[model samples]
Target: MRAVIADGKGGPEVLKVVDLPVPKPGPGQLLIKVRAAGVNRADVMQRQGLYDPPDGNAVLGLEVSGEVAGHGPGVTAPPIGTKVVALVASGGYSEYVAAPAGQVAPAPEGVDLVDAGGIIEVAATVWSNVFMIGQLQKGQSFLLHGGASGIGTMALQLARVAGARIATTVGSDSKVKIARALGADLVINYREEAFEEVLADHGFVPDLILDVVGAAYLRRNVEILGVGGRLVVIGLQGGQLGEMPIGNLLYKQGSVHATSLRARTLEEKRSIVRATTDALWPLLASGTVRPVIAHRHRLAEVSEAHRAIEDPEHIGKELLVVH
Candidate 1:
């Protein structure tokens, strides 16, 4: 099998394709013949040596769409040859990957199997952080940063379907249109305007905020929250250190949570995957939620894929087709 390996992590130039022995499934795992793999910000981080995979895993990828080739002990359902998409800890940038069986879900009906690779990570993250951990509910207001991002795009549609008033922050004017077309009730160009002020001007304060910028937006995120608001931080692209104003947070009764899907225990990831499959699949099948892929590249062109992800003009996901 061919897989991508980073040579001493630095930039996209460090990624190289290499032939390796196919990985075997472990207990309760499935050997998936990868058809497509989602290229993500985390993948870039890993390539740059900023993020490390779980122990023993070195390849770079977090989600994939493929067909089940075989199963390990105690695994049964996603029978061999069944088309599926899975959330994986690592090793997805290959022709074959071993995925935990419990984290694999049948490809959504009406979705192209190749495109489904882009859905698993965003779906699981949004379902877990925004809906489950953030406690966003119908009739509430939700704000998500990076409206044009893979996770942001998915979160926008899911929040709309949940009957929440959705607001998002994008980096450019063109992205404002894209975000609005995806069901955002309000879209702010963070480059020109303050998102908190925009929300306030619209007579809304978000009950939940899904943030990727982390520390850079923390103070304003707290100020813009409605009473009892929850801010879930899933990415720290804006640097990690920041001062928290406990008094303001206490006054608003706000909560702050930081989480990462990749570092989670297998069982925890499985649970999130199960919930996402149940809650998000129907929406995807019905076209109420859709995969937003910005670009696709051959698996061997991983450097190009990584470049596209870092390009501000790129919206949504970049997929690496393996087969």
Candidate 2:
């Protein structure tokens, strides 16, 4: 089988596709014949030597849409040849991958199978952080950073369906309009204005914020939180370290949480998968929310896919056709 790996770590140039023995599933795992895989920021970070796979595997993808070619010991239900999408700890950028059965779900009805490759990771992340952890409720205000991003786009749509008052920050004016069209009640072009100030001026105090910018916006995020607000930090594209505004947090009775889906345990991931499938599949089936694909590249063009993900103008998910 062919798989993508970072030869060393520096840039997208380091990524190379090489031949590798196909993996057989272990107990409770499913052997997935990869069709397409999602290209994520974490994959870029891994290539740049910033992030390491939890399982110490060098393969560079996190999610794939494929078929259950076979099952491992103790796994049976999904059955052979079932079309599915899976969230894996590593090794998604390959012709085949072994994923824990619990982390796999039937591809949503009505979505193209290849496009479904990009759906699971973002859906699981948003469901776990925004809905399950942040507990965003109907009528509450929600704010998301990187409005045009894969995670941002998913968060916006889910929050909209949840009946929340949605706000988002994007890098360009065109993305601002796209965010608005995606049901965001407020969209700020961060290149032109500070999101905190714009949101405040609009009197939109978010009860919940899904942030990817990390340290760059921490203080401002806290300052703008509504009473008893929850802020979940899931990415650190800006930087890793930041000073917490203890006084402001105390005054507003706010809470801050930082989490990463890639670092979570299999049990936790399984639970997230179950919840995400149950809550999001119907929405996807009905076209209430969808995976936004900004670019699709063949497996051999992995370097180009990585570069596309790092482009600021890129909106939505990047996918690698593996089949």
Candidate 3:
């Protein structure tokens, strides 16, 4: 099988497609014949030598839409040739990938199979962090960073369906419009306005915040939390280290959690995938919510896909079509 990997940790230029043995499914795993794969910031980080894949798997992709080709020992239910989307630990940027069975879900009805590649990762991440862990409820104010991003776009739509008042930060006016259209009640251009101040003016004390900008936003995120608020940090695009405002956090009875989907145990990922599918799949199928795709590149153009994901003007998900 052909797979993409970083020849050395550096820029997008370092990415290369090479021939590799097709991965065999392990216990309770499914062998998916990849159709398309979602390109993500983590893949960029991995190529830059910042984030390392769990268990030493080196291929650079987090999610895929494909057909089941075979099953590992003890796996049978989905059956061979079932169309599916899966959240994977790694190796998604390949013609074939072995994913734990629990992380695989039937592609949502009415969604194009190629575009479905982008859905599961963001859905699972938002469902696990924003809904499951933060417990965002109807009528609560929710703040999300990176409103035009793959995760941000999905979070906005899902939060809207959950009946939460949404506030989001984006860098461009164009993205602000997109965010608003996607159901964010408040959209702040962080490049021009301070999100904390804008939300304050709106009297928006967030009950939950889904943040991708880690250290840079930590202090401000805590300062603006409502009583008993929860802030879930899922990415560190800004930086990794930050000082926690313990005093303010304690006063508000707020909690801070830093999480990553890639490194989670198999069972944890399985549980998240299941919950996401059950809660969000119907909305997706009915078009109440949808995946936002910015661009698609053929598998051989993987470098260009990475470049697109890193572009400031990029919005939503970028996909690598493999078949």
Candidate 4:
């Protein structure tokens, strides 16, 4: 099988395609013949030597959609040849991947199998953080940074369906339209004005904030939260270190949480998968929510896919077709 591997730690140019032995599934795992893989920001971080792959895995992908070719001991139900999408810790940028059985879900009924790869990561992340951890209730307001991103786009639709008023920040004017189309009730152009001021003017103080920028927005995020608000930090595209405004947090009775889906235990991930599928799969099947794919590339063009992700003009998810 052919897979992508980093030649060294650097830029997109470091990615290389090579032939390797196909991976075998471990206990309670499924062997998938990969059809498409979702390229995530974490993959870029791994290529730059910032985020390391879990333990023995060196391949650079976190989610994939493919057909089940075989199963390991004690695995069944998603029978061989069943089309499924899986959330994996790594090793998805290949023609074959081994995923834990519990982390795999049947591809949404109406979705194209190739595009389903983009659904797993964003779905699990938003459902777990915003709904499960952040505890955003219906009718509460939610704000998301990077409104045009894959996670942001998915979160917007999910929050809208759940009856939450949604707001988001985007980098440019064009992205404002994109975010609104995805169901954000309010969209702030971060380049033109401060998001905090915009929300203040509109009398919208978010009850839940899903943030990817860390230190860059820390103080401002706290300032804009409503009383008893929850801020969930899932990524650190900006620098990691920041001073906590304990006074503001205490005054507003707010809470801050930082989490990463990749570094969790298998059982924890399985639980997230189960919860997400139960809540969001119906929305997907009914076309109430959709995968927003910005670009697609063949597996050999992994470098180009990475470049597309880094490009400021790109919106939503970039996919790599494995076969």
Give the worst 10-residue stretch by lDDT in candidate 1.
50-59
Task: Estimate the overall C-alpha local distance difference test score of candidate 3.
Answer: 0.93
Off by over 4 Å in 1: none
lDDT of 1 by residue, 43-104 (tens): 99999998998865788899999999998888877778999999998999999999988889
| Model 3: residues with Cα > 4 Å off, grouped in runs | none
Task: Give a tens-digit lDDT track for model 2, residues 1-323.
Answer: 99999999898999999999999899999999999999998898898889999899999899999999988999887888999999998999999999999999998997999999999999999999999999999999999999899998999999999999999999998798789988899999989998988987899999999999899999999999999999999999889999889999999999999999999999999999999999999998999988899888999999999899898888999999999
Instruction: Give residue 65's error in model 1 in angstroms.
Output: 0.6
Summarize candidate 3's per-residue lDDT along 1-323 as a digit string, tens digits.
Answer: 99998999898999999999999999999999999999988889999999999869889899999999999999987989999999998899999999999999999998899999998998899999999999999999999999999999999999999999999999998999999999999999999999989998999999999999999999999999999999999999889998789999999999999898988888899899999999998998899998999998999999899899898988999999998
Error of 1 at 241 (Å): 0.1
**Per-residue lDDT of 174-240 in model 4, one digit per residue for the tens?**
8899999999999999989999999999999999999999989998899888999999999998789
The clash number for model 1 is 0
lDDT of each: 0.91, 0.93, 0.93, 0.92
